[model samples]
Structures are given as structure tokens and as C-alpha cells.
Target: MLTEEMMTTTEMILMTYLFEIDEWLKDKKVIQQQQAQLTKEELVTVIKNDLTTFQANQATDYEKKLQTTLTTLEALSEAQFQKMKLEILSWGPNVKHVD
Candidate 1:
């Protein structure tokens, strides 16, 4: 039905349209690849950012816990020193001399 010797205008138009469709499909594939690469890059950036924030938060939480422990230790030391002082004072007036 198709030959170069008897080529029709309708056949020429159909061939042109087929070539255009192939070109369009190629262009679409290229664009999709580019978009996929961009999406991957953006995801990596977001993950890095989240990891940094999580590390910062962990550091801050550790520092706060350290400070709390130090404060509690200091308070206990102070209370122990006061108790010793009170006991010594109480023994002063009630101490009996061994003659």
C-alpha cells in the first residue's frame, strides 16, 4: 500500500506526525530524568538538615542533664556540711569533762 514511487500526501503527513511524536517522547524522558535528579538532591539536603538539628538537640539535652546532676551534688554537699556543724554545736554545751 505504500511505496516511494506512489507516495501520497496523506502518507507524508502521517510520517511527519510520527517523527514529531517520537521527538516529543524523547524530550519528555529527558525532562523526567532531570526532575528525578533534582528531587533526589533535595531529599538529601533535607535529611542532612534534619540530622544536624537532631544532633544539636541531643547535645543540648545532655548539657542540661549534666548541669542538673552537678547542682544536685552541690546541694547534697552543702546539706551534709550544715548537719556536721549543727552536731558539733550541740555537743559543745553538753560535753562532760573526764576529770
Candidate 2:
């Protein structure tokens, strides 16, 4: 994901896959928002099963996504990680990086 260098064909394809993953992550968040319809007026027990299912699914999905992200990062050499040091440091704690 170097900004300065032109990506190789494989890198371009991988980038597309990463972008797709990012989009799916965003879309899943929306789905979660829709599913999490808690009301102050009334709480229902029926929602519990669905909520539990969603939580479990989301946790599993997140773990898979994290592993995929780690794979991309783990491919990078130390120099590459250094090149991305500033960007990684700039990110809040949620973003993972080698540095």
C-alpha cells in the first residue's frame, strides 16, 4: 500500500480485495446498527437471541478480518513498516501496526 510507488499487478489485485473487505466491514456495521434497535419504552426478550447471534457472528467476522489485515501487514518488511510509521502512529489505538 505504498503511496509513492506504482503497485504491481498482484498488489493492485490485493488492494482491490482489501478495499472490498473494508466495504464489507462498513456494511456489516450498518447491518448491526439496524439489528440493534433498542427502545427506552420497552425491552423485549425475543430480541436477545437475535442480538446474541449477531454478536457472535460479528466477533467471528472481526477476527477473520483482523487475520486478513495482519496477513497483509505481515508481508511487509521492516523497511516497509518504517515507511508507514508516520501513518501508523497517526492512527488511533484501533488501528494495528508493526511499529
Candidate 3:
């Protein structure tokens, strides 16, 4: 019952709508890709920051351990020196001067 002209018009309208929808879909895909890229970049930044913080903490712990070791060694050396000096003094009056 439809005329040929009417059918041609209807086909043209449908094609136009299909083209618009395709363009919209392409734009949506591009937006999604951009968002995904931003998310990836943000994640990378966070990981780098976390790694930096962790390295700093490890260095601080190592420095503290080194300081403690050095302090302990210094204390031991001081005690040994005191004992040796006392022993030398106890040999008083009988110690020969080696010229």
C-alpha cells in the first residue's frame, strides 16, 4: 500500500540515523580509551611514589642499624683501652723505659 517515493524517503532516514549512531559509538570508544589511559597513568604514579617511600624507609632503617653497631664498637674499644691503661699503671716503678 506504500508508495515507492515514501519507501525511498524512509530508507534514507534510516541510513542517516544509522550513520549518526555509528559516529556516536566511535566517540564513546575514544572517550573510554582516554579514561583508561588516565587511570593507568595514575596507577603508575602511585606505584612509583610507594616505591620511593619504601626505599627511603629501608635506608633509614639501615642507617639506624649502622649507628647502633658503631656505638657498640666504640663502647667496647673504650673499655678495652681503659683496662690496658690500668694494667700499665699497675706495673709502676718497675717498668723499664726502652730508649
RMSD (Cα, Å) for all candidates, in order, is: 42.9, 15.4, 42.5
**lDDT for 22 (candidate 2):** 60
TM-score per model over all chains: 0.20, 0.30, 0.20
lDDT of 3 by residue, 9-94 (tens): 33332222223435444542112232223232342344344435556534665344333332332333444434533333233222
Pairwise TM-score winner, candidates 1 and 3: 3
Kindly list the per-residue Cα lDDT of model 2 for residues 18-39, writing each as its tens digit. Answer: 2344644454211223212322
Lowest lDDT 10-mer window, candidate 1? Answer: 9-18
For model 1 the local lDDT of residue 23 reads 48
> Which runs of model 1 end up more than 4 angstroms from their true locations?
1-59, 78-99
Candidates in descending TM-score order:
2, 3, 1
Candidate number of the best TM-score: 2
Instruction: Give lDDT: candidate 3, residue 55.
Output: 62
lDDT of each: 0.33, 0.35, 0.35
lDDT at residue 42 of model 1 (Cα atoms): 44
Write model 1 residue lDDT over 5-68, tens digit each, in one string: 2222222222222234354445421122322232323423443444355565346653443333
Q: Rank the candidates by lDDT, best first.
A: 2, 3, 1
> Which pairs clash in model 1?
none
